[model samples]
Target chain A: MSKVRERTRSPEGDLPAPTPDAKQWVVYTQKREGAPFKWAGTVEAVDTELALQYAREHYGLDEACVGLITYEHGDSVDGEYSIGPLVPQKADGTDGDEWLVFTLAKRGGNHQTAGTVNAPDAATAINRGTAAFADGKACNIRVVLASDVHETTDEEMVIWRTHDMTYKLAKGYSKQVRSKWTRIRDNPAYEQYQKEDIETHF
Target chain B: MQNMLADQLANIVLMHADDKLMLGHIQSDWTGLAPILEEDIAASAMAQDDLSHALVLYEFLGERFKLDPDAIAFDRDPCDYRCCDLVTIPDEFDWATSVVKRWLTATFSQLGLHRLATMTEGDLGDRAKRLLDEQTIQVTHLNRWMTRLGRGSIESHDRMQAALDRLSSSAGMMFEPPDATLTEDESFCCGRDELFTEWAKGIGITLDAAGLSATITLPDRSTGGGRRGEHAPHFIDQHAELTEVRHSDPATSW
Candidate 1:
């Protein structure tokens, strides 16, 4: 049987759903040479403008003499966001312990995948990344930790170049990697048998 | 600085200082509770700056009256406070109200602080001006969000409008006349600068058109005097929170 994805049927079906309750994000603005702007608190919106607009109403407007903006990953990457793993939820309602940090330098530098973080939030992760960057002496870099990131397992696998055989290379790197979103089987441990098969290639 | 004009000027200056102190007090409530972690931390820094500016003015005022610092700060009642009515309203948990309110306060504060900074008096006058320069940084911070939301999505536009509606009316009191002490000096004091007028011209809207969601009316004098030792009972709790250790065993230093 030929397989067809659901979104292939409808264009409007492509939009991501709204973030659920208690999973909302609040925005803060670091104004240029100004008091940190504490705009209104709002839930994570679908679009950056939506988030920023909510943020602006919440934090700016009454004050004058500046442009309004919130600098976050969603504002930049179109759909590359959320391509990896869905952010896991913490029982405490704050972000999870695990984190993935990225550092971008050299005037719109590519966010060098510095590594992942197991820290609490983006700020702390950035602090660590900044120290690392400063030590390495890489000047003029923007540090952004992949906020709200986590996973069920670090050593997971993605199906290697074929759909017929259950042969997945360990650690998710493959000749043809998935994009947008992918379902790796209900149980990631199922890939264990394939892990044994990959040792031969090594 | 000795003229009634100067004295009135002093009252005006006091009003500005008092407003910062009071606004700072209210804003600090959000230090740990802001919606986002980054925002909460950022807001906390701003709160500290506001309080620091207040301290600068309070120190000057303390020297004038020979009163202890806390007495000028926590001891004063609400009616005694020279803060504009805009700051006294309960903090709406919503960020819209907080930002809009802060935005309004910062704009006026920038002008007021600058005026004080340039005053002829060398002592507090010069000091207040320096504080004002620092405060301008905050104005820049809040203004960025204003433009974003003002030109943002429809939902954001409505929310901004609603915040304006809710917070605008209280703004009138920001410019109300000071108690007799403020009127004592004129040369170095505050003038009824068309702040509202300038604000409208700079931003391009009357308070009504700005989309504030609430109306503020100055309360009758019965619950008056946050500056001269009259205050809400809630202030008692605040004093307790801030001064518990300091007041407890004053002989024991931390």
Candidate 2:
């Protein structure tokens, strides 16, 4: 019955000029202090500040995350996906800027923070990172300049709230919703309804 | 005296809860329809945050009043609700208007919650403090969008400006006292005039950065608005749409 919903407008003229898309930034989340950060997702933002904000709102709030980091998508260099674990190479060096290293455990698994390497450039950083972190256990290695990775500071670690956040999680509503349903229906019927609800809704 | 203070606190809490509920409902409608995929997810997540914040406030009131939180949220008559008209105004799904409206409200909410956090009255202060932590994310995102779109292309800049001009008057009305009796009590909410000054100052800095200008002045207290329960027609329809499911089965849990 909303007036805006009922109202219809005709096209006035040609469409406006299209604006260029924002840069993509890959996000990673650390579940707790001292935990290795794992790949979470990506967000599009114009700059590092906005990217970190977007990452916090999207990935950080999606679960119980203590910290998160983001880097420009283009800034990362990914090693080839191997059928098995990658063998540690002899590409060792410690000459230049720091590069944060992340490693994949398997083909489809998420990349997690392993360690760091010091190299002159991205290519050398990846080489040195593979040499240091890929110890026959990781299937792939990824490296990005430490300067490009934006992390949540100690003060900003309240990504997960102290208040009751059960309202957004599915399990938060399960108990109350089930008890309410049981008031009118029998246990069997409630179970069937729960099944359909999960399939259709959740 | 304690009872009166509690009543005023409840009124302020209701105003904030209702504002967030309506804002979340409207913003959620744009989930699949936003301008871009990333923005769509970001806006939707913030909408969920708003809804969760509303539930938290409603639960606070529920414990104090011995009423169910869901009933407090959905079963209220239109006049009993205390959200500002700025929140209920239709954005027509326009991104510029949506972003502008959120910026204006988020700025006010940040200031309002800051006042609540200063209060030593029970868990209200603690709850507000917790909510303020999350409010930073919304304000930062909207402020950046305001600046980015305002300084973007000519079309975007014009759209943002037009949206700001359209919503400025209602934005000022957000400072109106939900209860006229509380107007004289500076301690009730740190004084409406003072709150407006802080709000306008915060808003001005962002507006200046965005290169967008609009004169936002506080409205007269005598002129009643949504806070006083005199809602516009759009709110009536929105309220119906929001409670349609609950209305069908008031006793059933949703």
Candidate 3:
């Protein structure tokens, strides 16, 4: 409650510093249940669990959101990477892996989840992505294979394990806006208006 | 009797709006100062929801009372506003306290809205239901934080406990009946007894989930007349801040 200790503390001072293991996670939010999940934004969390919480706070709070899905940045491979056989002279130019495609139709627009295309590599997936989903307005497109995803179980989430670090979770900041409020409430103008206000009422 | 009921209902609605407006103002103060960046944005978003709800309620009141929404909100004197003492509690700069306060207030608001939704029919009922929809996110956000802090680190648990202790006395003020006259209408959707019982049960469930005790008792209605047009002792400060811009150079529009 004392202002001295609370006021001067630094931001993120109590929270644990991000370790080298922290990774960026891309989040997709579905505004309502059964609605299309749109690319919302990104969050930097040490793990998927923290990413979910941060993603909820960052993007989910502003609107009527129902669902959120996060993908680790490293788990995804771009379709552009497999551009070797652009014009595949032979029939065997494609691999058999099914790559999921996503498209960013406009600048600053959310990347809609496009359907998947079976291809030999990431580059072929990009071509298939363009052919299947492109409407001539796509600014960027990405593709990732299904096999690269590393899903963590609930019991494995490390976000809940920081028992020694209380400061990071909730104790780092102190705000004094109401201290001035207390003084302002005791002003004579307020006292004067209290009586006058009653008179104005019918 | 009908006229009295109308007056009492309008007053009750205004009190609801007043509570939301003051809470919105206080929470907005945490916009840039929250303990964490994500929390800062979340707090601002919740504050926006509170203000938005207040705006809707004020507009509803305007329709009934034949007053402009702006006048209803900004032109009122300090003692005329009917916001609860819990929303006016001074910022102790403690994150746990802020989150806990939000949790408790949001819980009470949710229950009140539930009772309202079930009690009234037609326009008032529709508005209550709509406001309840918007409150879903705030309730979820606050509940999660309450649980996390309650069961998180030892320091967090202790801080949360201390905040509960500090806030327990006035938190019950939120459940106080709007006004004695309002409850005289048999058609009214809910009574104070039902509201208090539902609120206590809901809050107990939430607190118990957060690893905290569920021992809240109602405060005396006489002492909690924010709903009766009796402002808290510290309400003038909030009124000063609220009216400062509008009152300054009253000749020009802000």
- Estimate the TM-score of every prediction: 0.50, 0.88, 0.70
* Most DockQ-accurate candidate: 2
Writing each residue's lDDT as its tens digit, candidate 3 over B139-237 gives: 766777788778877878888988899888887777666665445233135556666787788778778888887457776645546665576666776
Worst 10 residues of 2 chain A by lDDT: A1-10
lDDT of 1 at A160: 15
Model 2: how far residue B182 lies from native, Å: 0.9
Which segments of candidate 2 are over 4 A away from where they belong? A1-11, A80-82, A153-156, A161-163, A166-202, B1-6, B186-188
DockQ of each: 0.02, 0.37, 0.10
User: Candidate 3, after superposition: displacement of residue B219 in Å?
Assistant: 3.0
Model 1 whole-model lDDT (C-alpha atoms): 0.51
Clashing pairs in 2: none
Over the true interface, candidate 2 deviates by an RMSD, in Å, of 3.6
Q: Native contacts retained by model 3, as a fraction?
A: 0.16
Instruction: Give lDDT tens digits, candidate 1, residues B157-234.
Output: 677777877767656556555653433135224444444456545444433343333444433323335433344465
Task: Select the stronger candidate by lDDT from 2 and 3.
Answer: 2
Q: Which of candidates 2 and 3 is the stronger one according to DockQ?
A: 2
Candidate 1 error regions (>4 Å): A1-202, B1-10, B180-190, B203-253
